[model samples]
Target: MGHGTENGVGRRAVLRGGLAASGALLVPATVAAPALALSGRPTATSGVQSGDVTATGGLVWVRSDRPARMVVETSATGSFRNARRWTGPLVGPDTDFTGVTRLHGLPPGEQIHYRVLLADPHDPRRTGEPVTGTFRTTPQSRRSGVRFVWSGDLAGQGWGINPDIGGYRIFDAMGALDPDFFLCSGDNIYADGPIAATQALPDGSAYRNVTTVEKSKVAETLAEFRGNFRYNLLDGNLRRFNAQVPSIIQWDDHEVRNNWYPGEVIAASDPRYTEKSVDVLATRARRAFSEYFPVSTLRPASDGRVNRVLRQGPLLDVFVLDMRTYRNANSPDDQAHDPQGILGREQLEWLKRELARSRAVWKVIAADMPIGLVVPDTTEGLPNIEAVAQGDPGAPLGRELQIAELLRFVKHRRITGTVWLTADVHHTSAQHYQPSRAAFTDFEPFWEFVSGPLNAGAFPASALDGTFGPERVFVKAPTASNVSPAEGYQFFGEVDIDGHSGDLTVRLREQDGSVLFTKVLRPGLVGQ
Candidate 1:
C-alpha cells in the first residue's frame, strides 16, 4: 500500500518519472493545449490509456491539464507493486479533459501494471507527474493463444499529425504488433478533415501538418469535437499506441461528418457546418465520442451505443459494428422492404441475439462498414448509399436488407466461426463471401479481411457488391484517389487465434511491417 513519497519524490522515483513521462520517449505533436499546465500539480500530458479489455476488466483513459484528480493504479508489477486503486473523475472542460477509469476484479490472463495520477482538484495530495502503462488481460484459457490488431481511417484526407512522418507512425507499425486488442475499425477521427500547414503533394513534395486551432476548422463546436480527440493525443506514436494497446472502439462517418446520416442536413453544397444539423453534428459528435474512447458501450448514462460484444476469450468474439449510428438515408439503395437497414432495428436484433449467443470460436464481425464493398455516397451528385453494398447485384437492396438478414441469420444459425472484420474504404482488401457467386445465397461462405488507412488518405478499391457473392481474393489499392501518407498505402490487420489449433490467422498488414495477405481460418468452418 505504498505509492509513498509524493513531494519528496521516491517511489521508484515516481516509477522512473512515470516511466519517462509515458513512454515511447516523446517526440511529436498535433496538440491543442491552451497552455496552463505549469505545476499547480495536475498534468497528465495526454497519455496513459487502456480500454475495453476484459477477462476480468479494464478501461483507464486520462486527460487532465487543468481540473484534475484522476487516480487509476492497478499493478501486477512495474514496481507499481501493491497498487490497486481507481478514484477518478473531476476532469474538466466538461470532459474535454477526459477521464475514463473503470478497472475491475482483474487477474485473468495477467500483466496489467497501470498508472496515471493527475491530482490537485484542490489538493489530492497535490500529485502531478505519474503516467505509466501496460495491458494484456483476456485469457480465460482456451489453451491461451490470441493476438489482435485491426485498424481504420485516422487523420484522413488532409492528414494531420505529421511531425515529419513520425506522428502516428502507423502507430509505430501498430505498436510493434504486440497485439491483444486494437480493433479500431472506423475512422477514429477526421471530423470532416481539415489539417493544413502544408500538404501539397502531387509529387511536388511538401506534407507537413502538426497543426492545431482545433485542426484549423471543420469539426463543429463542442470545442471542435474535443479538438478532434485532442488531435490524436498529440501522437507520441499515438501515445505509445495508447500505452500499449487495448482499444476495441468503433465509430464511422469521419466520426461525425463525411457521409453522416440520421436526419442529415448539412448540405448547402457543404458549408463546413454552422452546425447544420446532422442532428446537431451528431449530438456534438456523440459527446466528443463519449469523452474520447474507452468504450464498454460508452457509459455516463449510456446511449452512446457503438454496438458492443468484445468478449475475446474462448478464442474471440469482437462484433463491434455501429455502422455510423444506426444508418438509413444516403440512398440510391433500391429499397425492397428496408427494415431501417444498416443495422437499425435494435441493432439488427442485437446482431441476431449476439450471433446466437457466441461461445467464441472466432465470430469477429467488427465491421464499421464493408459488406461486399460498394460505398458511394456522392452527396449532390446524388447517387448515394454509403456502405453495406448498394451497387447491388440483385436481391438484398438498401443497406442490403440489413446484410441480407444478417447473412440469413448466419446461414440459418449454424454460425460457425463467422469472420468479417473491416475498415472503411481507404484501401487494403480481401473478400470471399460466396454462395457460389450468386445474389443472396443465404450466407455461410465467409472471410472479409480489409485493412485500413491508419495514417489516412489512400483510396482506390471499392466495388464488389455482387450481393453477398464477393470474391476479390486480395487487392492493394492506391493507384489514385486521396493516396498520400507519403504515397505509401498505410494499413493494419492481424488476428491470430490458435490456442491448440482453432486456427484463425488473418495477417493482412503493410505500412512497413509488411505481410500483404495471409488468410488461414479453419475454426469450425463452413467455408474453406
Candidate 2:
C-alpha cells in the first residue's frame, strides 16, 4: 500500500489514472530536437523551467511548443558541466504540452542553475534559454536566521492592468530581497466557469468574474485551471521570479470557484440552481491543482489519491491548509452562529497535534481565509457594515463568528510562535486578537497577517481603513503612514523570523520595493 506519483500511478507500474483518461487527444510524439520553422517563424518558448524545489529535489517543469521529447539539465552554473539530467517525452494534453520532471539527487546548500533542451529535428537548440535559480537545503534546527515571502489572491479577472502591474512590482521587489521561499495566501486565479472553460479578462473596468451571468461552467474546470496557470507562467516577470525562487503555494476560493465551501456550488450563493452539485468541479479543480502545484495531500482518500507536505529548513514549517475542500462554509444550522467553526473537527484536531510537535522556529498556518478578522461587524465605520448593499444586515456577522472560533482554539492551547496567514479579503494587514479569558491567558495573543492578490485586485484604502480604523483597541502602532482613502497600492507581505528571540518581523511591501508598513511580534507579546 505505497503511494504513486502525481497521477496516482505506481512508479513501477505502466498504467495511468486521473487525468490520464484523456490521453487519446494528447500531442503526438516527435523526435528529440526542435523542428525548424519556416524562414519567418517565431521562436517557441524555451529553458530549464523548474518549480516546487525543496532541500532534496524539485519538480522541473518544461514543455515543447512543438511535439518532441525534452532533455532537462540542472547545474550550479550557466554551462552546466557536471549537471544532473532528466529525459522524458512531453506527453498528453493533461500537462498542456508541459513536462514536469522530478529532479532528484543534488547537493544541499548549493546554488543550482538549470535548462531544457528539445533535441528534435527542426531547431536543435535549447527551447528556452538557460534560466538560473538558487536553492538551499533545509537547515538544521539550531540555525536561526531565515527569510521568506508570503502572498496570495492573484485573481485579477478583468482589466488586466492591475495583475500585470502588481505581478511586475512584486517580482521587482522580490528579486532584490530574494527570500528563501514564497508563500501564497490563496485565490490565485478568477477562473469562474465549471471544470472545462477558460478565464478571460475583459477590456473595461470590471474586475470580478462575470460568472453570475455566463452560461458555460467550463471556465472553472481542469482545462481552465491549466490555462490560467499557463497564462500565469507565461508572464515574464512571474516566470523570471519563479526561475529564481522556489515557491510554496496554496489555493483559495478563486482558484476553484468564488467563496466555494464544501458541499456547495457556485450557484449556491443564489437560490436559482441550488440542486447543482459541484463535486465534479471540485474533483477537476483538485486534479488541475495537483498537476500545476507542489502541495502535499493530507487526506487518506483524496479522490483516491494522496499528496504530501513540502518542507524547507528548521526556520520554517508550513502546514498548508486546504480549507475550502473539507470544511463547511457556514454553520450547519445558522449562517451567523456566534461560534461558527471553520477548520472543522478533523482539521482542528490535526492542527493542534501538528502545532504541539513542531520544532521549527516558525510554524506558519497558511490558511486561505483570515482567522483573525471579525468578518461581519466588530465596529461600524467599516465598509461592510455601513455599505451593506442595503438588505445585507448579517454581512459581517458570519466572518466574525469564524474568527472567534479560531482565536478560542489558539488561546485554549496557549500556542506560541504561531501565526496565521490568509487571503480572501483582498487587502493586506496584520491584526492581533487578544483573548478575553484566563484558560487562554498564557497564549492570549495571536497575529493574523493576510497577504494576497499578488497581481489580482487593488485594495481600496478607504475600504480597509474604514474596516480596521475605528476598532483600534490593542492595535499595534502603524509602521508607515496609515493607508489613506485616496491613495493606496496593491501589495504583498514579507516575513523574516529571528530565531534568537523567537521574534517575527512582518513587512507590508509594495511591488516596487517600497515599504508600506512594518510590525514585529513575539510569543510573549500577548497576555502582557
Q: Which candidate is the best by lDDT?
A: 1
Q: What is the lDDT of residue 77 in candidate 1?
A: 73
Tens-place lDDT digits, model 2, residues 274-381: 335666667776676666654434212344322124555666677777666555543222345534255555665666677767766567877776543433321212
lDDT, model 2: 0.50
- List the lowest-lDDT window of 10 residues for candidate 2: 1-10
RMSD of each: 19.8, 10.8
The 0-to-1 C-alpha lDDT of every candidate, in the order given, reads 0.78, 0.50
How many clashing residue pairs, candidate 1?
0
Q: List model 1 lDDT by residue over 254-282, tens digit each.
A: 87788878898876766666768888888
What value of lDDT does candidate 1 attain over all alpha carbons?
Answer: 0.78
- Supply candidate 1's per-residue lDDT for 439: 79
**Candidate 2 to native Cα RMSD, angstroms:** 10.8
Cα deviation of 526 in candidate 2 (Å)? Answer: 4.9
List TM-scores for all candidates, in order: 0.37, 0.70
Clashing pairs in 1: none
